[model samples]
Target chain A: MNLDFSFFTLNIISNFIIKGLLFSIKLTLVTLVCGLIIGTMIAMMRLSKFKILNYPALGYVVLIRSLPFVMVILWVFILIPLVIGKSIGSENSAYITYIVFESAFYSEIMRSGIQSVKKEQMQAGYAVGLTYFQSMRYIILPQAFRNMLPVILTQTIVLFQDTSLVYAIGAYDLLKGFEIVSKNFNRPVEAYLIAAVVYFIICFSLSYGVKLTQRKVQIAK
Target chain B: MHYTFNWSFFFKSIGGKETYLTWLVTAWEWTLTISFFGFLVAFILGAIVGIFRTTNNKYLVTFGNIWTEIFRNIPLLVQIFLWYHVIPHFIPIINKAPRIVLVVMAIGLFTSSRVSENFKSGIQSLSIAQKHAGLALGLNTLQLYWYALLPQAIRIIIPTLTSEAMNIIKNSSVAFAISIAELTMFAMQAQEETARGIEIYLVVSVLYFISAFAVNLISQFIEHKIKIPNQTFVKQ
Candidate 1:
């Protein structure tokens, strides 16, 4: 079982792996931006005084959190065509699903972040003649965001890892790129080996960066 | 919203062998079995690895760190692929191993890394005074950990560990990639066959939600039962 990675030359890397890497990055970024925005809203809703707002947000988060992420991906893929009477490709479906699915997780993170910001901050904003929204926007959220940046970044790494699951939906993600190259070169084992290495390098470095930021945040405190 | 629902498809048997509901029940059992074994492996091994990292021994600490980083960094899906396809090639004896065994190992190994991280932190989060006090009393390292360290650490870590425990159950769904016919796998298959895509996915999602929620409730109950009464000391 002699391994031959000669097949993964520059040509294959440039064409297949690079393409998949780009999609993975794109999906991660889009999901991060959208998920965080929506997650913040959900977090706020959960924190809200209104029972109508709180219970539904609570239910959504609980429901999404309980199921497997892969099932969410698959459900979105199946549901889109059924509901719309036509199909958006798996990549688009994945975008929608990830934004929806990851919001639950991000919202939980955000809620903790918000809670960490003391009630005094909100009261102080009100004392300064600020409205509810003004207090949230100008006072509460910025501090919460600063505290939660590392946690959110960590979740982004998890999302990056999860983008690989789009392979199940037949999306041309980073793992899919490796699969294609492996098929072309007939080196299944080496492809998988390299793929794992690539994922490890990217995630481990990002996590290391997050650790640095966390330390910096600690020192700032 | 107007699509007709054919809910009875779950009651109809394929080729008079077993109903779709029964088939799904079997699939659910497989999912539970895989998750149970996978979590068992992760919890035990992760605890050991976590302990190794905190120990004074230099080599064990490095080895434990390497183990955690390698498994934690790579996605569980890719790890599953490696266990399913790649590892068997080098080890001929296991090439013929069953799919379920390989899938369990993949999920277990991947989750153990996460579990190990939590354990490391739980142990580290304790005050140095505890260790010093134990040493002062002439407690050996083993007794120190068993009495002074682990009991407290376990309580502190239960909330986080509960999530990891729930995670392995969800992680077990990646076995679908290898067609292990677990809940996720069977859900997709049932959708393709029955053409009642929404209903099938809904039922499966509900099943997953119930199970995952059950784990959370159980952990909460355990946490309540073992609460340290009259806690006056501040945890650092």
Candidate 2:
């Protein structure tokens, strides 16, 4: 019943927890990059005029958005091995699943970002003798990215929180690191408490930075 | 080897017991219960904190800000684990409570931070003139809020609240980690028992999609019904 701070030894953290902290950061970076690239493509497809382009993209986003991220992670974890004829370890599965799952969310942000760019700007690009793709490349995407950067970062903060769920597949995320130390030291309560504090510090500071960026963006407009 | 899909397992009795479909339905009930009750806790706590956020009292504002930051920043899973594993150690009464109660509270506090932000914005969106007009008429701040401000603010933020509602439902799936018999748990258990991971997960996903879509439809209908005419939404 006692809440003890005595159990938190420097030796325990340095030995068992640092690997998980590194892995969590690595997984988050990979997911952000891969999710953004695929999400941008899906956003374009969803915005396209043709049904062939839009329907599948729309369906994918809707379907993924509706389900829980944990479910999707489990599905990929279980099903990927069956398809590939070998078990990809939990880390690889977590990476793939997060990227695929997060693309749905990132695409939504991109879609709104894309929509925020003025129609006149696209017209102006065309008037200046640029092709549609070239204009989008040079004009629209840049503006959209600038406008949506804060929102994108905010979502990435949420994504970072979700990286902890990789614990379901036995992936050594930050939370799992705490669990390991807790079991090893007979201090599940302290471990979880400290874990919460660590996650809170990271996410709070990141989102605070996002709020500042958002204000700057608003001022620029 | 090609995996053969068994579509009939959904209706057929599992090991000569109840149908697999029934098990899922039961699990779905837990999901709904957690989300609905969690939403209630979120809305009530969020409304109070949100009001504090909008107030001129510097101390209350700081307190509200700190509360929101602490809850909003931490992952829900970590919160759930803390509540489930650690809270009982500190609060002896919690040891007697059901795990589901703990799960609901964890999800509620986690969601309250998000809902409070929406509420804060809704309150802020009212034209300053509304506040001035209420003051000019000799109404106290409480009466001004009760009679004029809150109704309008709630109407303005209904759309955002609806999405938050859907979010709570999806997030409730994390309850399975602590062994709540939610949809995710049912799917995982069924998959393991049947070795039909693909089919089980696909069905679970569809069920989740249907439930979320239904909430969206119902909330949209409510928003349409309650909309204040000619009032534009506050731009993000």
Superposed Cα RMSD, model 2: 2.1
Mark the 10 consecutive residues where model 1 chain A has the least summed lDDT: A74-83
**Each candidate's fnat, in order?**
0.80, 0.90
Going through the candidates in order, what is chain B's TM-score?
0.95, 0.93
Minimum summed lDDT over a 10-residue window in model 2 chain B is located at B227-236
Candidate 2: what lDDT?
0.90
**DockQ for each of the predicted structures, in order?**
0.76, 0.77
Compared with the true structure, model 1 gives a TM-score of 0.96
| Residue-wise C-alpha lDDT for candidate 2, range B57-110, written one tens digit per residue | 999899999989999999999999989888889887998999999999999999
Give per-residue lDDT, candidate 2, residue B77. Answer: 96
- Model 1 per-residue lDDT tens digits across residues B1-236: 47787899998887778988988999899999999999998998999899899999999999999999999899999999899768987997777889899998899889899889988898888888989999999999999989898888888899999999899888888999999988998998988898887898888888887778888899999999998997522255
> Candidate 1: which stretches are off by over 4 Å?
B224-228, B231-236
Which one wins on TM-score? 1
